[model samples]
Target chain A: MYENKRLGLLYCLPFVIGVALFKLFPFAMSFALSFTQFDLIEPPKYIGLENYREMMTTDKLFPKSLGVTLMFVALTVPLRLAAALMVAQVLNFKLKGINFFRSAFYLPSILGGSIAVSILWRFVFAKNGLVNQAMTALGAEPIMWLGDENYSMWTIVTLNVWQFGSSMVIFLAALQNVPTSLYEAAAMDGAGKTTVFFRITVPLITPVIFFNLIMQTVHAFQEFNGPYMVTEGGPLHSTYLLSLYIYDQSFKLFNLGYGTALSWVLFALVATLSAVAFYSSKYWVYYAGEKERS
Target chain B: MMSSLIRSMVAMGVIALALGSTVVSGQELRFSWWGGGERHEAFLKAIKLFEAKNPGVKIKAEYTGFQGYQERLTTQIAGKSEPDIMQVNWAWVSAFSKSGDGFYDLRKSASVMKLNEFTDNDLALGTINGKLNAVPVGFAARMFFWNKGALDKAGVAIPKTWDEMFAAGKALRAKAGTKAYLIDGEGYDMILMSHAYVYQKYGTPYVDPKTGKIAMSAAALKEWASIYKRFQDEHVATPLPLRASLGGVEKPTEQQPDWVAGNWTGNYTWDSVIRLRGSTLPGKGSELDVGDFLTLPGAKNSGVFGRPVHMYAVSKRSKHPEIGAKFIDFMMTDPEAIRVLDLSRGIPSTAIAFKQLLKEDRLRPLEVKAYARIATLNRNNAITPPAAQFEHPRMQKFMREVFEQVGYGKINADEAAKMLNEQGSTILQRL
Candidate 1:
């Protein structure tokens, strides 16, 4: 038993070392760097909370970018979740060639966040692109999907929402785990399809839904590729999320200190939101074997 | 287990010894650059010639297209893993090396490098804080290059003055329909063109390098903003929104379909890029012509944006600094190397290479014309070279935003002017 334990420890050492070097070390260094004025060329100078104070007081893009990020997360999370749930429901049906349909739906998610896909998204939403051609064929005036500031965010939001396969897969698994006898009983008692879905299917899948809501919201907050590659946070910076702002400041502008500070704030925001989700889960999410608190 | 560990240790030692022997055998220098196919081919040939001339000194070439080159260089520099030699931009010298220590001081390698081959003005552009950070490859200035085919289709000639250009823009659109514009550019291009117009009329640069402050008053800035607006309003230039719809605002004009189709007729771009613009256009490049530097009446300056095309700098972290310097000298002054490079990197800065290329009649017609025009403008004291601060990315972004706001009608000319004067000063002061 002791030999087995020693071998297990030996096997885990590489992973432990990797996490320490790559993940934990950078995490700690970034936290420390948030207080310094590091430009990657010169040595970092400690300036206390000046970075955070500037973000609040004088950094004009901070508030604007934060608002954009929140809007992006709010718009992306629910729409993506709703899309995943609906698609998962349809895909869960006993239909012919369902596996092919499943793979096709999941394809975008596999290629979604790539730079190439983002470039393709730009062309598809371009003035004389496929979307506009379709509109023209339907005898409608083409919309400036990427050019108009009001419509630009929607283009990226639609891109994010379109890649709902991962969340749908999770939803599909949860739906499969749901008891078939419950649906049969509801059906015999004259429960309508919509009634059975809401009363049985939705309630039972609440745990997975909650899990997905938290995951998707966190993922949405950190979205960089779609906006960075597609719109470049442009058309008057309507799509300039905080992640893009951080990247521009850190890499492009070389304001590593301020970028790190902004990153910490983003981390805190995601953490607080996730904590709130976990705290509120008991109200809506039901596990199979949990006792009633009351 | 102990025997296996000993065997592994012996194998690792053998590998390390092999690597050590290879390093001792010869000096390897890594050289990086960003360019097109022709430039890359020319550079590769030059590198091969240099390697042949210098035995036991191997040159490794790393080349990429223009996109993301700066970002990659930045990360590499920060990590201390940059190439031994790099092709740097003039604007990047100050950003990367403020006190003139970012790159290896070329002045230290004066014995190895033929620094005297370049003119003082050319060398001064690459020097900062009494330290020669890099050597200028060539000089470039923004000039008008028009598509004669497109202009003829619209029944217009290349305009020589500001008012004539505006009239031409309107007339061309009237003749060629709404899809046609006399000029096509991104926001940054429009801002620079507007700066030239304002500078010619007012004799003030956007940023005064002497004091490092915003030089234009609110009224002058308002005129600058107004010129940009008028260009779009008169159908002389494409609006920001419309350009944004055509791929992206960041897309180069040469890549646009309108440019290929000759709907967007012309651009005010750098002389070095004239080859790219001319080559990308239709009809065997005969349709392209370099226009006269357009000026405004009663103007004091040409407002020609003149700078180095690019520069070669040895990295501070390079292990083979002498080899790197020698290679740079060969590229600049060697006759065979110059012949191989030809006019790919614009007109050569060195007198030897320039005379060699000129005597060989290797200079392209349009590029030569643009260079001659810029030289004339410079000789007559008609051009005021923009301060290096004007090319700062942050400053460029701010200027682009202000003009974009004016173009989108989100703000009036006066408001944009106020922002340029007030906010622009604040940003410049910080830098």
Candidate 2:
């Protein structure tokens, strides 16, 4: 037993080394950098709490960017997870070309971080673009989807939610694992489709939903490319997210110290939010073959 | 398994050593610049010519699109892995040349090349704190490019002053009936032109020399912002949404000489854009006429509307500072380099190269005209340096936002002015 445990650890050595080097080392370094004023050229100067203090008090754009990012996260996460669940439920139906539909829906998730999709997004939402042209064809006024501050955030949110395939696939797998006997017994009791879905299907998939919600929430908060490429945090800084702001400061303005500080703040916020989500999941999440120990 | 791993590691070490030796063996220089495909091709051709002349030096050309070049360059600099020869913008001079010894002092290197060959202003732009840090390749000034055919069709005369320009725009709009406007409502360039006009009228640049800060004169800000607001209100400029759809007048053909091809009027841009337009949109039935850089009426000196656009700076930590300085000198003075580069990097700054190109008839007509115009303007006026804080990306973002706000009519002139004062200072301080 001891030999087996040693072998297991030996086999996991590569992963352990990778985690230490790539993740832990960088995390610690970034934390250290947060305390210093480094421009990446001259030696880093230790200026304790200056970056954080400035960000908290003096940085006019920080609060605005933080608010915008939070607003985006708030709008996107629940909507995206719910949409994914709905689609997964539908895909779970014993329909023709199920494999094809699944693949087609899953394609966007695969292409989510790709440059091609972002370019396509730009074209789709650009003024006189596909969306506006469609609106015109429908005898409605063409909205300035990207150009107007009012509608630009929605454009980004829609882009985020549109790639719901990853969560959908997970939900689909979870639905397949859901016991067929429960649904059968419910049907025999003259339970309607809606009743079965709400009572049986939903409870069984709650764990997966919870998993997806946390992941998507974290992802939504770190949303950078959509806003960076499409609106460029513009139309009066409406789409400026914290990540984009950090990037601008570090790379564009060469303020590595302040950028690091902003990054740490973002990390803390995500960590706290994730903790809260995990804590809340205990109440709603349900796993198969588990008693109500709580 | 351990033996196999050892074998693989040995092989990897051998490969790494081989690659390192190969890189060290060659007189390799990594040259970086940001431009489009044509510019890349031209640069490659120039590199090939240089390599053929000096067989030992092998030039490795690196290029990127202009959008995020500065950011990428900064990262490379911070990482202590900057390219040997970099095409740096002039705005970066003050920031990059932080200390006197940060970049290669060109004056102390390369006896073959002489600095006296280039224009005084061009040479001066490269000099940070009396040390020649970089070499200027070209000069470009923001000016108006009018479509003669469109103006003729509209039967409107070119305006001499701001008020006249407004009246002409209104007349053109009235005549064309929503199909045309005098200029694109994209941000800042025209406003800068307007600022220059006011500066010429007042004989004070945007920055006050005495205070060593931005001369945000309330009157000047109000006048400039009000004029911009008025331009929007009069429909002389395209609405924000329309302008946004056009993608800043440079991207869409319908907005360019095509707008002229379709019978609209003039646009404002640096002169090189005219050459680009002429070549790209050949035989578009539109002729580009270089208009005078507008001066405010009754001005003491019509201040020259030019900035030191771009300079070639050696990295402070360059492994081969002498080699970098030599390359810059070659770029500035070499006849072969001059022929290969042509006016692609705007008009040549060197008087010898300028004369050589002029005699050879290699200089573009547009470039010649631009140089002449700049020279004429320079006789009476001095070049104004951009505000140091304004060089920051935050300031650019702030300006872009305020411009959008003003363009979209979200806030009036008063609100924009206030935001500019507050946000502009904040960005500066943050930097």
Best model per DockQ: 1
- The CA lDDT at B321 in model 1 is 89
Question: Candidate 1's C-alpha lDDT?
Answer: 0.88
Report clash pairs, candidate 1: none
Q: Count steric clashes of candidate 2.
A: 0
For model 2, report DockQ: 0.42
Q: DockQ numbers for every candidate?
A: 0.60, 0.42
Enumerate residue pairs that collide in model 2: none
Model 2 fnat value: 0.42
Please tell me which predicted candidate would have the highest lDDT against the true structure.
Answer: 1
Candidate 1, residue A109: the lDDT equals 96
lDDT per residue, candidate 1, B145-227, as tens digits? 89998898778989999899999988888888898889877667777888889988898888986677888867789999899
Best by TM-score: 1
Q: Rate the local accuracy (lDDT) of all candidates.
A: 0.88, 0.75
TM-score of each: 0.95, 0.92
Say which docking band candidate 1 falls in.
medium
